[model samples]
Target: MTVANGSEPKDNGGVTPPGDVTPSETPDNRPSMSDLAAGYAGKAGLQRNSAGHVDMLKSAGGVQGIAESILPGLVFLVVFTFSRDLGPSLIAALAAAAIFTVVRLVQRRPLTQAVAGVVGVGISAWLANTTGKAEDFYVLGFFTNIAYIAALVVSIAIKWPVAGLLFGFVRNEGLDWRKDPERLRAYKLGTWIVVAVLALRLVVQVPLYFMGEAGLTALATTRLLMGAPLYILGLWVAWLVTKPAAQPSKPSSSAD
Candidate 1:
């Protein structure tokens, strides 16, 4: 029997059509490119509200998550500014991260974000302490931005724009959007928007990083402002611009 799309239905005991089959059906059960892309999008923490719009706050990991991300850097900046001591500044930052981890544990929530925050803070602290330069605390962030920009650019170059993989799944378009030239172009533009965000961070922050301890306060402040908040703004814009056009409804036929 023909389905709603006017295609004959398969008869493999309700198995998904070949085009829709996921990697789990394969002999090795290895994930396909689509599965990998979808998993990346899922882990990105982007969420949709009941209205079907991207929830920016939720995507930034809610209030607690935002605090977890910002508190450490803010503590480091404040402590360093007042005491002019790298040791106490690093310790305060690490303490903030640890406190968040403890809070997550007490609440029995998923520890991934908390644990990652702690690790990142620890690395930053270690790097700064080892270098005996407070400015070095943000070095890790520079590398992170570079890595993300590189990956996003490569995805665009390969024509598998990360924005398409991400928003396509979020919007329920799946991989089908790749088949539409207009959708593909829109997604490419979306990917470039994200790329611009990452590049902007480097362009603005890397200069401050070279200014050494003299620019530490400004560097930390900008880092806090441009971190999650800037990222969410860019992602929101990308999501909006890449939105799929509404499908035209087919006219119904009257029965004779």
Candidate 2:
């Protein structure tokens, strides 16, 4: 047997030489799951910026996203108030959503928010018109809140807060944030905030829904009051909670 560098033999009978070995050639050299997990951390960090508000808006589709979200309901309310006609009110709301979608497409912005807005308005209008009850227009929102509450609770139960996953994913922090106790706690807190917002929506709107026609206007008001503004507030708090912890300074070296 011949040795290289006065160490182990380069080849012994059937054994392959060290120089021919590569990471992919051996099972021990295979990349671990942790390595894959860490690889995305840098990318997540790059996407997340210092301005949490802007990032939140970006996730929703920016200032235009806000407009798209609110305008449909606003238009429906205003038109319904003046016309006192369900068909016309629904039409106006749909038109407003369509306009937002068009504007988003023309401006080359993301269509996810715009499309969602249009669909939500369409469903709400369909429910109200089909059921011959104006209050049904807000029914979709009630179900949506319930769904959100369930989802948030489920995510927390699984030890993965939706707020943390979403914010970390956007910030390029990936699942690495979960490894930090402080960051994980922040994410849990943030997830609860979202749960609270959804719960509040259900609490306020459900009663109004059962009130019949008299509650229609009140339902609309409550929807507006607790809609985007409350969600944004929760998002902001989550961002604050997830902020990176300050690193401890290294101990100063003693002079010899």
Candidate 3:
């Protein structure tokens, strides 16, 4: 047997030379899960098999993505169930939803963003009045209006990193609370107006709760004080709902 350098091999039990084999490459050489985990480990400066938690943010949104994930529907469920007596003001919710839908169409936003923004705000507003505190009602509405957007952005950032950037666009640009300056302020005033109306409704509800006409029905309907299970649940969720995401640690350059 004879071996040659950098030459094609001849038949008859001959050995091929060095550089005789050509490597085939294709675009479909996708990375394996181990490769991806390894890549993230390298990027994050993690040690092999270290006792490190899986970074969901790197896996998902980082922060804002987690917020957007659960907020919209939670706000919706809270408002729709508690504020069922809004009656005509229900149109406010509907109109906001329709107009926001059109805004999405004009801006060519994701269908879900538009839907969530409008409907979520409306429902959140309705639930804002459900709080027993009259003075804080509008203030709560104004703030909660923005919460779901924040939440949606957070959730998307976590569950789907790619889609999360879009969430930021809608929150920052669509809401325009910061740059526009007046948008959040306008929401404040609008909240006040709606709250005033709700306040009036509460006054009227007083008679119903006090057994003016219907005794048992009115008693069941009124939730002015915060001792009830539903009210307590609302306050609990509200408290737990808006906490910030845990911050990831940065790599230290110096030795310990």
Most lDDT-accurate candidate: 1
Candidate 2 regions exceeding 4 Å error are 1-47, 50-54, 169-173, 180-182
Residue-level lDDT of model 1, residues 1-256, one tens digit each, is 0112123222221212224445555357665555555556667776667675678898899999999999999999999999999999999999999999999989999899999999999999999999999999999999998999999999999889999877776666668888899999999999999999999999999999999988888899999999999989999899989987888999999999
Better candidate by TM-score, 1 or 3: 1
lDDT of 2 by residue, 1-256 (tens): 1223222223221222223333344366553332233323222221234543325555444567677878888888888888889999999999999998888789897676678888999999999999988888889988888887998899888878877656664444646777787888888888898898889889888999999878878888888878767777777777777667777999999999
Best of the candidates, TM-score: 1
RMSD (Cα, Å) for all candidates, in order, is 6.8, 12.2, 22.0
Quick one: ranking by lDDT, best first? 1, 2, 3
Tell me the number of clashing residue pairs for each predicted model.
0, 5, 23
Q: Which stretches of candidate 3 lie over 4 Å from their true place?
A: 1-85, 118-256
Candidate 3 residue lDDT tens string, 1-256:
1111233332211212222221121134443332232232233321111222223332232233333433333333345456644343344445545665675578675566456555555554565456532222123333443554455344333432212122112122221232333443333333333333335444544454445223323322332231123222332232233222356999889978
Model 1 regions lying over 4 Å from their true place:
1-28, 249-256
Worst 10 residues of 1 by lDDT: 1-10
* TM-scores for every predicted model: 0.87, 0.76, 0.22
